[model samples]
Target: MSHRPIALEPAAVDVEVRGGIRPADVRHAKETVAALTRLAHEPVLRATVKLVASPHPGERRTAQAVLDVRGRLIHAQATAESTRKAVHLLNDRLRARLLKTTRDWENLRGRELRDGEPGRRHPAPPEEPLPHRPRREDPVIVRRKTYALERAIPDEAVFDMEQSDYDFHLFTEAATGQDSVVYRAGPRSRGDGYRLAQLDPRPGLLGPVRAALTVSPVPAPVLTEQEAVERLEFTGRPFVFYADAATGRGCVLYHRYDGHYGLITPTPA
Candidate 1:
């Protein structure tokens, strides 16, 4: 129904198979990798898969996958009885990696506004978009959501948010790291203006960097955990709800690209 594979860009898979001197072993290694590569094109979320074999490991082979998205890297390692099993293990590992990648990319949206476009000079590693299928709970809000901001000078911040596909773009003061927000800032009717959110308590360990879906077209606001709650109560403008304290009142409000408002709140009753 919804985009199943969250990854649009495929991660490069590298494998090293080592075992007994058998032709099947070699064939299986190649086949498994070929399968994943082919899946990448279908809907399994694949990019480039490279397989290598050597007699170094002898009896056992290891799977090492360096899953990277927009420079965000996650390493997965698994040992298996055979190269086929190892590839399967790597497949599972990549699924988990994408989950983490999805959440992190969402949060990065807030910081990209002023930080300049992601992958400008060092652009994201060459990868393909993986087919994304949303879970029942992970509903599909929208597809290909797009918005244009006032010429956000030094476009790096905006670029990063685009790369991550965040609901709201958070901007950092050119020299000061002070945070600002840019989303549909005017009345829901006028549908214009991306206001600067008011962050509170600022951010620290166990911080409030999280946001709610109701905050913007795409929910995560760009601000430190401490300042995440600070918002200007402008009449008729989209604003974020927040609570800042150990008393358990804080949230990073935002909207999914689908137009669903969400609240990334703290753990309370």
Candidate 2:
């Protein structure tokens, strides 16, 4: 079967290489990403590629890309010993995601393509493990990000989470106007593997959600930052999501790849 190639405007794709990458390598990364974007079936509104040099010897370079395809965002990341290799791996990961998303969208609309069609399913590549982190006596918060929480339905939040390769996503529930979080409930083998937690959830407030989600009956815990940190240490979970007692907003405190702590708080809307 022959399919028309989609051409993306050169200006729509942005590439940024950091950590002293050479000009030739930067151009190579950009061209590679551009070629990947051109294969999209839908209009590629915008594409961004970021390459960072890792200090660790195990994975010397990391490549990540985010694509805005007809208003939907898709993200992929890869790491390799060399810059060119990293970009090539990123391309493979992004291609698989694009194909899977297209197949899922078509299925949702009851327009599934034939078995050997262009949008045939492709399994995503396994993610690279985090670089080794030196043991630390006490890991303090090394990074903090504050931004306005995205207001979206649970389905939208889940989609954003999966696209961004995030384990959990914090957002304001559009239906109830409450701060909420949706996270992976368990391994992929488990049912849908999605769960929802809302702040002061009320009975019969949620509408029909496309993803199978287990809503927590208990309201989200309200805690100060110090208290949250203490709970994080006690529970040994990857992240702790809670409502800030001072500002009454959703916040996430999680373990960073470098064996440090990172905090994400919602700014005032």
Highest lDDT model number: 2
List the lowest-lDDT window of 10 residues for candidate 1.
Answer: 126-135
lDDT of 2 by residue, 1-269 (tens): 76554656545568886675777777777777777776677777788988887444454577889888788778888777787888888888788677667656544333333445433222356555434243457878888998888888777777667667667898999888988888888753343558888888853777776565778888879999889888988887778889999888888888765567889998887
Model 1 TM-score relative to the real fold: 0.27
Structural similarity to truth (TM-score) of each candidate:
0.27, 0.71
lDDT for predicted candidate 1 compared with the true structure: 0.37
Off by over 4 Å in 1: 1-59, 67-74, 99-104, 108-269
Question: What tens digits encode model 1's per-residue C-alpha lDDT throughout 1-269?
Answer: 54443333222333343334355544554444444333221243333332333333343444445434434544444445565665566566544444434544455445532224322212222222211211124332232222222223223443344333333454432422333353434332342423334333222211332211122223234444334422422221233644434433334454321223334443433
For model 2, the stretches where C-alpha displacement exceeds 4 angstroms are 1-28, 41-46, 52-61, 68-72, 79-86, 99-123, 128-134, 137-142, 188-192
Tell me how far candidate 1 lies from the true structure as C-alpha RMSD in angstroms.
17.6
